[model samples]
Each structure stands twice: as C-alpha cells, then as structure tokens.
Target chain A: MRVLGIDPGLTRCGLGVVEGMVGRPLTLIDVNVVRTSAQLPVAQRLVTIEKGIDAWLDEHQPDAVAVERVFARSDVSTVMGTAQASGIALVCAARRGLPVALHTPSEVKAAVSGNGRADKAQVGAMVARILRLDAPPKPADAADALALAITHIWRGGAQARIDAALAAAGRRTS
Target chain B: MRVLGIDPGLTRCGLGVVEGMVGRPLTLIDVNVVRTSAQLPVAQRLVTIEKGIDAWLDEHQPDAVAVERVFARSDVSTVMGTAQASGIALVCAARRGLPVALHTPSEVKAAVSGNGRADKAQVGAMVARILRLDAPPKPADAADALALAITHIWRGGAQARIDAALAAAGRRTS
Candidate 1:
C-alpha cells in the first residue's frame, strides 16, 4: 500500500510518500517541503500549509497517512504551531476517508534505526540506506518524513490489520 | 462589528457570536458548544469541529473571528488538543477571507474583567454582567468564548485599524 508521511510544522512541513507493502521493496514516490514565511499572518501561513497538503493529497493519493504525533517536549513550551500543522495533515487524510496513524518520533526512529534514542543524523543515514538513495532527502524534515512513512509500513500496517480483524471478531461476537 | 469567538477543543468546543462596536452596547447573536466524543478518532473530531466552525461562520457572517490563542500554562498541561482545535478555527476563518484575531486568555480576562489574572469564576461573572445575561453561560468555556469576542471587539478592533493604517503608510512610503 502507498503510505504518505507528514512531519508537520508551521514554517516548514515535510512530506514523503512511499509505495510498498509487507516483504516488498519500497519505492520513493515523492518528497517535498512546504515552506511558509514566518512574517505572514498566522492565518495565511496555515492556509499555505493546507493548500500544499491538499495539492500533495490530490496528486499522490496515498492509501494511508502517517504523522508524527505532537508531544510536549519540555515542561512548558509552546507547541501550538506544530499541533496546528499536524491537525491539518490529520484532517486532510481523515476527511478523505483514508486511515491515519500517528507515530511518535522515537517510534519512527526505533523502527528505522533499531534504536529509539537514535539521533537525527543516525536516522537520516539509515533512511538513506534503506531507501537506497545516495543522499538523504533535503531539509532534514524531509528525511524524517521518509522514515515516518517507512515506520508506518513496517509497524502501523500490521497494527491496522490486527485492529480490523479485532473489529470483525467483535461484530461477530456482538 | 460582528465578532465570533471560538474556544477550541476536541471534546467540547465553545462558540459565541457578539455584535457591537467600541462605544455601543454589545448584543449577543448566538452561543453554543460543539460536542464531540472522546472515543472518536482524531481526524473525525477535527472534521466535526471544522464543520461546526463553518456553520457558525456561515450563519452569523461575522466581520471577524476571535480565537483563544493556545498557551502553555504552568498550572495545566492539556493544551495540545486545544491547540489543534484552535488551528481548525483559524483555518476556517482564513479560508473564507474573514479576518481572524487570537487573544490570549489573560488579554481576554483583562478586557472583560478588571484584572488579567482573574479566576474563571470572575471572568464568567464579568461576562454575564457585560453581556446583560440573566445567567452565566454554561460549561465555562462558552463564557470564556464570549469574553474573547468582547475583548476583540474592544481591543483588537482598534489595533486592526491601526495596522491597516500602518500598512497603507508603508506602501505609500515605499
């Protein structure tokens, strides 16, 4: 199944799409970074991100979407912008009736690099190797998005199947 | 000017519309809460919120939208869902070419009450008195939303005019 991964941000959102299924070689379909000026009004910046995401969704039409779940990093820091961007991605996929999954940064790192605590460079290197690219995708967020997509294919795909089976069994029992 | 205030949330989003100007008594246009189940998926919840915001905007045709800006409060830690919801409110307003303003809780408190650090009860009481409501709006958030709308009317309206003047002057100078 084709999976689209989004590393969401207000200033810069990374998007990557991968075509693959279990036990199959994955192919990179597209990768892009939607960048908005910080000087723009908050509303306009969100509109830019929303339009970019919409364009990608229309063009690529992935079956599933994986997004990095927003987490409170420090004790008290503003994550409103990131959360806003993530909302856009989730809504885009969800409104289209596609299954959406949120994978944490550590989860994506662990799935791709075999270590949850892997640093950015390590994750990027692994993504490059796994995707068989001579170099990682530009603008770090892009590479991270690719890793998220790979993680979803390897991890969330199985979980989704299990969830569906459980639902089916639940219906039969009920 | 007509103003729509949104206290965004995933579970229960508060919405209030008020019509008035700086030197006039404000009139309550409408107020309601958009309720969504916690059991719903994140995307579905956002969609519900988007629809609700759209309906309000369409029905009221407000001149501006005032949203509670997401803040990381030291006393609490449940701002992520609120931030996501705030993003929906913003995008809904922006996409329709409606001017949107974000007011900090303290700003709304200061505008409605005499103190920025006023408690919820204080804000609610003030909101009821200012709007000439016989009773305080239910579920606190709704009251807070009205306070936000009032704040924007009394505060942001002037600031928006000033900003427009500055932009015009800058263009002329350039």
Candidate 2:
C-alpha cells in the first residue's frame, strides 16, 4: 500500500510518501517540508498549509495518510499550531475520500526503532536503514514523517480490518 | 462593517453574524450552531464544519471574520480539537481574502461587558443587551459567538490599522 505521512507543524510541516506492504521492502516515493513564515498571520499560514497539502495530495494520491497526533500536554508553546496544521492535513486527505490515520509520536518511534522512548537520532537512523537511504532525512521532522509512513504500513492494515469489523457490527446492531 | 464570529468546536461550533460599525448600533443578522455527532470521525466532523462555514459565508458575505483563539494551556482534553477547528475557521476566511481576527476569550468578554473575567451568563446578558435581543442566544457557545462578533465590531478597526502598519514596515525593511 502507498502511504503519505505528515509531521504537522505551522512553521515546517514534514511530508513523506512511502510505498510498501507489511512484508515487502519499502520504496521512498517522496520527502519534503512545507515551510511558512511566522511573520504571517495564523489564517494566512493555514491557507499556505492547506494549499501545500492539497498539492502534495494531488501529486502523490496515496491510498492512506498518516498524521502525527497532537497532544496538548506536550509542548505548551507549539501545540496549538501543531494541532491546527494537523487538522488541515486531516481535512485535505479526507476531502479526497482518502483514509487517514493518526499515529502518536511514540507509536511512530516504536514502530520504526523498536523503542517507544527512542531519541530522534535513533528514529532517524532506523528510518534511513529501513528505507536503505544513504543518510537520514534532514530537519528531524522529515525523518519523523517517514517513520510515520512506515508505521502506517506496518500497523494500518490491522487497524483497517478492525475498523471494518466495528462498522459491520454497528450496522448489524442498528 | 459586518462580521462573522465563530466559536470553533468539534461537536457544536457556534456561528453568529452581526452587522454594524464601532460606534453604531449592531444588528444581529444570524445566529446558529453547526453540530456533529461525537460518534463521527474527526475528519468527517471537520468536513461538516467546513461546509457549514462555507454556507454561512456564502449567505452573509461578511466583511470580516472573528474566531475565538484556542489556547493550548486551557482544557487539555479538548484543546487539540478546538485548535484544529479554529484553524479550519481561519483558513476558510483567509482563503476568501477576508480579514480575519482571533479574539481571546478574555478580550471578547472585555469588549462586550465591563470585565474580562465575566462568567458565561454575564457575557451572554451583555450580548443580548447590546444586540437588543429579547433573550440571549441559546447555548452558551451561541452567545459567545455573538459576543465575538460584537468584540470585532468594537476592536477590529484598531487591530486592522495596526496590522496594515506592520505589513508596510515589513515591506520597507524587505
């Protein structure tokens, strides 16, 4: 399955697309960041982000999109902006009827590095090794985005099946 | 100037539109809430909200938009969703090149009532009195939305001038 993962942020939103299945080797399709100036107002910044994500979605057209979940308890200063960016990402993907999943930071780290509490360097190293890249992606956010895609490939299948089952059960009950 | 105020939330998003200037008596053009089922996924809920806001904008064509600023430090559990909703609201306005302003809770309260720390009932009462409504809008969120519009009418002029000056200064420096 093809997946596009996003590390959502107002300043620099990371985007990475990966193609793979659970057992097969993954291919890196694309990796980039959408940067916005802090000098701009939040509304304008969101418009920039929305356009950026829309362009990416149009180009990649991934089957599923993975976004890093924002936790208000973490990072008091940037949490609001992060959450806002995440919302845009979710809406962009969902607008096209693409399935979207939210993976926590720890989930991405553990999926790629086998450690929930792995440091940035460790997660970056694992992502690079897994994708057979010469070096880890820059700006850490880019690497995190790749890790999220890998996590979705590894976990999204099972999650999708669970969701389907739940829907079926709900239909039956109704 | 007419202003559309949004109280962003995932479940019940409050919307109010008021038309007037800083000193003149304000007229309540519309007041309502866009509600989504909690059982729905976040992305679907956002789509509902986006459509709702779009309809309002199409119908009213307000000169400016005022949204309640979401603070990460407040209400940890719902802060993420609130921030996300606020982001969508901002983008919806900015995409149309409409002037958008974010009013903090305290600022909205202070603009309508005499105190910044006034309770919900107090703020609602003040909003009713100012708008010449027989009763405050139902659902505190609805009243709060009206209050936000009232605040924008009272304060948006000064804020717009300040933003324009800052933009001009930035252009000169660049």
The TM-score leader among the candidates is: 2
Docking class of 1: medium
| Poorly placed runs, candidate 2 (over 4 Å) | A158-174, B157-174
lDDT of each: 0.89, 0.93
Model 1, A3-90: lDDT tens per residue? Answer: 9999999889999998897677888899999999988988889889999999999999998999999976533443678888899888
Clashing pairs in 1: none
DockQ for all models: 0.67, 0.76
lDDT score, candidate 2, position A105: 94
The Cα error of candidate 1 at residue A135, in Å, is 0.8
Per-residue C-alpha lDDT of model 1 across residues B128-153, encoded as one tens digit per residue: 99899998899898998899999999
Candidate 1 TM-score to native:
0.90
Query: lDDT, candidate 1, residue A168?
Result: 100
Model 1 C-alpha lDDT versus the unseen true structure: 0.89
* Residues A1-174, model 2: lDDT tens digits: 899999999999999999999778999999999999999998999999999889998999899999999998878888899999999999998888998999999999889998999999999999999999999999898999999999999997667788999999999999
